[model samples]
Target: MDDSTLVASSKSGIEDRLSITAEFYTLNNVHANSAKYVLLFSSDPSSVIFFGLSPPPLINNNTLTLTSLALTTSFRFLGVWFSLSASSQFVLKQARSMVKDMAALLTLKKLLAQHVAYLYNAVLLSRLEFRLQTSLFFDSIVQSIIFPMFSIIKRKAGLASTTPLALLYLKIPFSIQHAFCRFLLGKKFLLILIFGNLPIMLFLIFKNLWVLRVVLLPST
Candidate 1:
């Protein structure tokens, strides 16, 4: 089918699935009030064409009316900024704001190097590390913001820029740090697959293999 047809089919399938789930919950005496807060996000603008001329409202029990979530450039959810285009611009903006806040600490020159390092780790690094593994964030752009701050901290610690901050701070490089986080995330997901219910494990394995066959193998 054409791209437009596929998009329409996908949208219809989502609505059908939501209706089915709501019915299932109601029948089982389970209170599934997902319509109250569920947000329908379109990752691509072209997907809007799938909704037809007038998309139907998600009406539950002829009372709760759920409208299509308004298209937004970005929205914050659980402390992470998600953009419709999936760009790392939001993350970069947040990182810049954090750098500004952290830089203010540098004015306290009298603070010991270890103290400053502790503050940086506690205040700045903690924020940057949030949801690091799952998101396909622009690593280079983020590192550009981070490394300079690291250099500043290194200078405060009486270490030259050439001296690797990782050695002095007992931390890994930004790239390696992200790599480690990804590794941990993969392990966590793998554990879930292995120990989860048989149906779930089978479904996930099938999905992974399908992706590998359709995308990875063809690319290679």
Candidate 2:
């Protein structure tokens, strides 16, 4: 696919692409390098995307090499920052005064995602030769995709002093936004919404409470 097609596809949902990319990284050494190169390309927006071609600094060593895995994880980290930068722009469109705090939180998330991605990639690289099934496959996908997405959402919400609970608002797209807002005006709005989305709402509430605690206890 072309560059625009690839970027548009990324919006489709990174879950499937992450799984497929993980599989490729498992099978071919080239894919590992390609993943790193993709991170590099993401870093430099002006860099030309050489579709269907080998990326810079070819992977000449064994796929299981620690050096290879380290580079891959490092770039995966840079990828997280790249995602945060883009998401920050979106948040700014909504809330400009929060930019400084948003940048700080985004930096924190970038570091956290890096650590998590490094650990996950290390595990995958070590188990490259082992037989992987659907369960483990999905587990890996969740590790790679969901965790990073959560980190981004958490950081974005932090910008507004909103906490991760704000991610609940994000789960619903703009199309349903007005409806949710109208519903929230009802007397039992939180009660109804909580009951309707108990599991997620609870999780979000926990995150929100955590933010409140942090705000209330500054020295803690």
Candidate 3:
């Protein structure tokens, strides 16, 4: 044969062998069963029939009760409002009983001691309740009381704003203090109420009035 004819015959033989392998792979379900290649025999295709092995029996659904509570790995704060309410009610009742029993003792010193402790607890409980209910009112009272006290302290420490008086009446801080001192030391003590504190008092009053007007105007 010529060189071209010989090459063509060799290619045809290789193609025929590949075609046979492909046909076998497509037609057969060849699976390795074990590490050592154990042959498994089966008849039913819908259900798996294990050969040379006894299958475990299925448990009956009705006989198996699933009362297993799903345990949550979490912290739950409030399970129910009844639990919290009942707890607070119990504490309140206990405190009331303690207070009543102490009152019944009737000795002055013991009564005072009991009253002091009760008052402290009552104040704390009232504060807690106030925070829970009427929060705005409680906050307003706190702000009103604290801000004025702070302002007074700031004023006494040579730090109070003299700008209002200065803007309204052209008086410096030293002059304001001097004026207060003179009012305390002279016949123009009426001017103490008139000048020293009058402006601050009037300013607060006017501020409150303006706020009230604004609040009421919306309603009206």
Highest lDDT scorer: 1
What is the number of residue pairs that collide in model 1? 0
What is the overall TM-score of model 1 with all chains considered together?
Answer: 0.46
Q: Which ten residues in a row have the lowest lDDT in candidate 3?
A: 208-217
Candidate closer to the true structure by TM-score (higher is better), 2 or 3: 2
Candidate 2 to truth, TM: 0.16
Sorting all predicted structures by lDDT, with the top scorer first, yields 1, 2, 3
Give TM-scores for every candidate, taking all chains together and pairing residue i with residue i: 0.46, 0.16, 0.15
Tens-digit lDDT string for candidate 3 (1-220): 1001001123234234323433332355322112221111111112221212112232111111111111121111121111111123433333344434433443333323234334323442343332222111233333332233223323433454542433221232221222222223443444455558686775554331100000011111
lDDT of 1 by residue, 1-220 (tens): 1001011224455445445544554565555433233333353332222222122343345222334334454545444565545566656677677776677657556765666666665656666666343344444655666665666667776777888545754553222233234435545754565577774755544331100000011111
List the candidate 1 regions with Cα displacement exceeding 4 Å.
1-40, 43-72, 131-134, 137-142, 169-220
Clashing pairs in 1: none
Candidate lDDT scores, in order, read 0.47, 0.30, 0.27
Arrange candidates by TM-score, highest first: which order? Answer: 1, 2, 3
On the 0 to 100 scale, the lDDT of residue 20 in model 2 is 45
Query: Between the candidate structures 2 and 3, which one is better when assessed by lDDT?
Result: 2
Deviating ranges (above 4 Å) for candidate 2: 1-136, 139-141, 159-170, 173-220
lDDT of 1 at 124: 65
